[model samples]
Structure formats: C-alpha cells, structure tokens
Target: MIRKSRVVLLVLAAVAAGVLLTAGFNVSPIARALLGDKEKPALIPAAAGLRMVPVDIPQLFKEVSPAVVNISTTQLMKFNHPQMRNPFGRQDPFDEFFNNFFGRMPKEQKRRSLGSGFIVSPDGYILTNNHVVEKADEVTVTLLDKEEFKAKVVGTDPKIDIALIKIETKKKLAYVALGDSDKLEVGEWVVAIGNPFGLGHTVTAGIVGAKGRIIGSGPYDDFIQTDASINPGNSGGPLFNLKGDVVGINTAIIQGGQGIGFATPIQLAKSVLDQLKDKGKVTRGWLGVYIQALTPETAESLGISGRRGALVSDVTSGGPAEKAGIRSGDVIVRFNGKEIGDEHELPQAVASTKPGKTVEVRLLRGGKETTVAVTIAEMGGELGKPAGGHDLSKNLGLTVQEITPEIAQRFDIENTKGVIVSGVEDGSPAEDAGFNVGDIIRQIDRRPVSNIAEFTKSAAKFKAGKTTLFLVERGEARILLTVKNK
Candidate 1:
C-alpha cells in the first residue's frame, strides 16, 4: 500500500507541473506571489546602478545658435606718425633721406573690431557689453545665415558694462529668452555660444563655478564666474543653460589662465533693459554716503557684535542720506528690508532702486538698532562722486591738538604750525566727513587755525544746523570738507 501511494503522489506532482506550464504561469513568480511577496523587478541595475547617457547637444546648438550674432564695429581714430615716401620701392640710399625729411603728420585711421551679441527680441533688439560698442562709429551685426544689419546704440550703462543696440528687420528674427540668474546654482551645466577670436558661432560647455564675484570692474561688480573656455571676441556673447535661456552675458576672461571666465548676470541687464529701450538711458536711485566694509576691528570699535554690514565713512551734505538722518559711523545693516551682506551689495542694491522711492534703512548706532525712512534721490550724473558731512564736537566727532615738533614727526606733517586731528569719535560726523587721526585742520570757514587754541575757538562758534567748511590737508592734497552741527 505504501509503494502504491508514493507512485500516485509522483504522478500528481508531474501533472501539476504540466498544468502550470500549459497555463503560461511562471512558477517562481507564482510561488513568490503565494508567499505574499508582490514587488515588481526594479529597472535600476543592481550591479551598475543608474547611468547617465550623453546628451545630444548638437541639436541644442542648432536651435539656439541663430540668436548668437557676430558684432563688428568701426571707429575713426587719429594717429600721428612720420610718413616717409618710398620712391625707390626697394633698398635705396635716399630711403633714409625721405624718412628724415618727413615731419610728424596726423592721419585718420579706420579701426575695426569684432565681438558677439544676442538678439533679445524678435524685433531685433540686441544686448552686448558696453565696452564692445562704446565710441563705435558704425556697428554691424551678422546673423548665422550671413545676413548683415546695421545696428544703432539704444543705450549703455558703463557702470554695469551693459549695452543695448537695435537693428531694423522686417522678418521676425530668432531670439533667446533671458533666464533668472538668481536661480542658477553653482555647478549647474552651462553653454556659451559666441564668436571667439573672430571664429563664428563656436560652442563651448562648462559649469558655473561661482556667483556674486566682484572683479573690480565697476561700482556694481557682481559677476558670474564660469569655466566655459570664453576667449577674446567672445565678449558680449550669450551664456546659456541647458534650456537655451541666457543666464549670463559673457564679458571677461583671465589671461594666461585656463578655464577661467566671467559673465554679467542677465538679471542685471534685464533690470535696466526697459529704461534703455524707452529712454536710451539708465537712471538709478542715489543715497549719498561713502561706505566701507566693516572689519572685525571696526565692528568692535563701534561696539557691534559681528563683522557684517557697511560702515558709513562719510555722508554727503544736503543729500538724501543726511536728510534721512543717516549719520557717519552708522553701520547700515539693512536697506529696503534687505539685509546688507557686505559693502559691495549695498551699492548694487541702492543703484537698482528707482529714484524718489522711500525706503527703510536699518542701522546700528551706539550699540542700538534704529530704522530711518529715506527718500532716494535721482542718481543723475554723480553716481560715484564723493561729497562731505562732518560732526564738530570732540566727544561727538573729532578732537584737535597743537602741531608740536613731536606731533609733526609722528603725523608726517611737513608744515609745523597748523592744528592736527588728534582723535575721531567712532561713527561721529567728523569721522564721516573723512577726518582721519592725522589730518591737519588748516582753516575753518577761511579762518586760519595756527594752533590748538585757534581750532578750539573756531569749533566753539559752530552753531547747530549750520554747515561749516573745514580746509584740511591730507597726504599732500588739500580738500574742503563740510560738517553740520546738529
């Protein structure tokens, strides 16, 4: 009976296997399903993990290169050189005779240069670097299809090194959209298309190395640094992202350095593009104050906690800042509700504001925080010019000492008679008026200060709400500094 049972069981198992095969049921999967394991097989390779395939960038270039145009400029320049007539045409004894006989003559020369730019609109408005089109007698733009158009300068902001030019075209021209530079992250992939070294429409790829870099190019020196092989003639070209949106305008490169280049953020150009398009000029808001970065020493001296914010070195007389009660030695921590990270950020922030806009300025004064409302003034033609405002009382701003022989040697004052600045109260108006510890106060309101007594007498006559002019000698330069006693 046991042998018969074993044979029966083997036959049943064989029949069940045949049935499962005929029914197209995967036995292992069925077994797993029966065991309550229902997870599907993952596509990610277990051994190799995820893989990145190379992108087809040639298609990207074809789509975007049409907007990248070659810029050529011609300027009429005058040159002075000795013109010698080579009558013999070959080596001759009289070659020296003509060279010596000809005097210096002024001649007109045509200087032609090449650069790159991008179309920002279908109507043919283009953007480029100011240095590329500055003083250009004639500007010409060449498209990828070899079509050329004469361009005229719309406007230029030399402070940011950006320019706007326009060309006339009946047909709708291809253009690239400007991207948000603020959103671009460092290490993000980027591509640059430009006419580098006069080579037309070259494409190079790199990653954004950094942002908010100050290159000392201008007062507003925010630059985007990249490593996309930007070279000469690539200036004013477009630095695009994977989506073909222009995030930066290629502007400068480091000489003798590989993989180092700089671009102006597109957001900066876009901010002033409307003004450039409408009025052919950019007008910015001005808060008349001379500001410097607060170092740890300066911060400690001013009784501040951190080495952040911009230190007010001087304030302009009758300017918007003074009108707003912003004093020298006041550390500006915030402007328009935006925290000032450093000195460079303040200039850019202030310049971007519209004129006549009332903004709140938060500052740290005497270890306390205060807010002031200031109506910004029109920048006009004096964007970077410096003026003066000072505080007079010794405990308030500055102190004077008699110019003794030892003092002359210590302060390097050649003249031995005038009163010298002995101390400057931190954040004082006199300090804000650009008074240093060694500055010699030669005269006050045209009254010559020969000694400390004379300076004390003149300072005692300082009336509140009156502007006092101080004739100061600093490093061989005589300058008049104005102070308001308040």
Candidate 2:
C-alpha cells in the first residue's frame, strides 16, 4: 500500500511539471512577441526565478543563430554504389534502370545532410567540415532569418576534415570570433548548437570531455572530445564557448555509446581556413620514401631504447629524399622546425610545409646524428611509378611446389606447397638455379605451376633469353619470385 501511494505521488509530480513547463511559464515579453503570442509552453527556461547573471542561453542563441547557418549538399554517385544505396539497405529498381540506360554515368544522389556552420569573414567566407562540403556538387546555406543562398566550396583538407566555403550574401554578414582551442581546459563548459537528427538549431550542453584524443580519424588525430549529446547531422558545426566564440568544429562520434563525442580543435581549422581563403588549394611538401614505425626489436637494431622516430623502409631514386641524401635505415628525428615525436607526426609536419621550400631534416644514420637539406616538392603531382624489384632464384634456377592440404594428403609432406627444387645435381642447372631446402615452386614463367610434371612442362615452355613469370606461392601468401636463364 505504501509503494502504490509513492507511485501515485510520482505520477502527480510529473504531471505538475508538464503543466508548469507548458503553462506560459518562464517566458519573457520579448520571447512572447517573437513567437507571435503562440504558446510553446515547453520552452520554459529551467529557472523561473533565475539568478541575475546566470547563463543566458536564449540571448546566446539570438546572437549565434545568425552565424549558425544550415548547410545542405548534393553529389552525383555511381548508381548501385555504396553511396547511393538506400538507408534501409534497398535500392529502387528505377534507379538501376536509369543507370543502365545512361551507361556507366553516375546518378544524382541528393544526400541532403543538415549541418551548422559559421561565417568567418565579412567578405562572405564560411568555415565548415570537410564532410559537409566535400564531393558536394551543390551546397546551400540558410541563414537565421530564413534567407537561403547558394554556396561554393573554396577548399577542403581531407586530413583534418575542415572545409572553406563562400557565398555572396551582399550584406554585412554576422560572424563569430575564433578562440584558442589549445587553451581550453578539460572541465571548461562548451556549448554545441547544430541540426542534430534533422532537428534544426538544437542546443546541447556539456564540458570538454578530454583533449588531444586520438580517435584514428586521420594521421593527425588530436581531437577535443566532449560529452555534449552530438548525434548525426551535427558534423561541421561549431562548438562554442560561453563567451560565444567558435572554439571547435564538431567532427566524429563513437556509435551506440554515451558521453563520447569528438571535435576538431579550431586551432588546426584556422590554419586550413587561412590557406583556403588565400589559395584555391593547399600545397604540401613531399618525401620520396616509405617509412615504418619501429618495433621493440627494430628499436634495438636501431640502437634506441623506446623505438621513437620514423624508420625509412625504402627510398625512391631521384626522389626528393634520395636526392637530398636521405637513405633507407635512417631514422628521421626532426623535419622543418618541429621535433618529430613518432612516425605519424612526420606526415602532418611535412604536409604543413610549403612546396619547393628547402627544409632541414634531421636523421640518425649508422649511429651518427646528421642533418640534410631537402628541397620540398609538390606532393602527388605527376610522379612516375617506380620499377619492379629483382628476384635471385629466377636469375639462376629454382623449382618448387605449392604445399596444400590435398597435396599434403597425397605427397605425405608436413608443410604446404613450397618450391621443391628438382634435378639439383653436382654442377647441374638446378644447382646453379639458387635452389634451397623446402622452397615451394608456385609459379613458372609468370604462370602457377604445381607438382614436378607441371613444373617440367612449364619450364620447357619458357624460351631461353626470355623472361618467365613465375607465381610461386610460398608460405602464408609469401611469394618466392625468381627470374633466371630460361
């Protein structure tokens, strides 16, 4: 009987709250005027008898909503492709029919996602997320007063996922000031205003969850994480400080989780924005080498304890690194003016540099620290493909077989198809053909050859002085390729 009474009292309390919230409660005269005397009732601010100098969200909204414009984009996508697939995992048969009639041409997919952005300049420059305007054939920006205008993408950086766009509003547009995102403390209050889940201009409140979080969005993943209930369609919106300055750009989230969301710190976005506003594209420095992060064993080999810095795995001939005297097995400790902490940091540092600018690169080679001056080149522009590598077994001679479960069942061998060196006698061609123990011959003359008879037939088909393509399936997808006198 006591439990029943408590439940009834709780229900009564909830009903009273609903009535008080919707009973024209906590509304100022100006709010009533703007809303045309229409009763929203649910818009009752939490504190009816609020403190004199409390956080005035509605006033903040009035100033912010003008700069917080809605962005909608459309792009052409290949019909039946991943981008054009229906949200429910079904495609309209009509869509496929249109594709067949139009050849391989892409179908127009109106991926209408709503996001929030803010104007940065009086000249109609706007900043948003790369995901908002990237690959967009058309973008439309709607202002607070319901004024809609067409927008053009100025530039975009996929690495940081920030984009710059422009529109000719023809009037002095409202804008926001950029605050130092690096100065934000973990417990500082931040507000997120966005079109989350298609509910336009929704506001959520939370504090900075953490800083310098690496969510693996890109090579440079130092994001400012927050707990402000951001959902889909909030990408590219501004995360604001209580002072109403744009501090961060809301970027990503972990799905099916609570109290976990992330935003790109505005400091990085400012760099990208400045570049895009001045130049149509960003130019980055290029190094002609592939690098691998060092493992503990590799760190020991490199004479380092913690295995820091990037280890050069390969050098491109005539490339910037090679020409600058950079070589494989060297660890890059610094680039330009910044100290490289690890392999991942190197890319971001290089990408920030201007093309054609000669920069100092520090490296450790042969246990000796050295510095080399490398002239930066424009990244990814007209670079030719490198030649294929050499194979020793093919240069002399080799024969092997692919060890398989079925073959293992037949040949009574312990392992999979390894090249079985056949006919290796004293001073014989097989002996000359670099044959080794348990070598599996998976290919001959560019074709796969299994078993002794198949190997013999394939070897006979190859003419001397001609290159034979041998697809030797070695252990675990490893290929033992050889080129030798046919």
lDDT per residue for candidate 2 within 1-486, as digits (tens), equals 999999999999998886556445765644554455443211233455441222455677777767887888877665454434566878867678766776555455456667778888777888888888877888998887788899989888887888899999668999888999989999777888887876677788778989988887886788998988788888888898777888899989998989899999998887667777788666667777666565554454446566668877546557888889886567898899788777777877787788889999999876788999999887775443221111223434553444557756754545343345433345534454344444456545434454556666666665666434343322222232334354
**Residue 271 shift from truth in candidate 2, angstroms:** 1.7
Candidate 2: worst-modelled 10 consecutive residues by lDDT: 384-393
Q: After superposition, how far is residue 411 of candidate 1 from its true place, in Å?
A: 18
> Against the unseen true structure, what C-alpha lDDT does each candidate score?
0.81, 0.70
Clash numbers, per candidate: 3, 23
Residue-level lDDT tens digits of model 1 in 1-486: 999999999999998887666345544433443444334211122245443221435667898899999999999998665434556565564656655675333378799899999999999999999999999999999999999999999999998999999999999999999999999999877889999889898999878999999888888988899988899999999998877789999999887989999999999999999999999889998998877777664565467788778877656667899889996668899999899988888988899899999999999987899999999999977444333312346533787777778877876766676677778888877877678887877767656778777777787888876667666766544555667666
| Segments in model 2 whose C-alpha atoms lie over 4 Å from true places | 1-60, 76-110, 381-486
TM-scores across all candidates?
0.70, 0.62
Measured with C-alpha atoms, the lDDT of residue 49 in candidate 1 is: 48
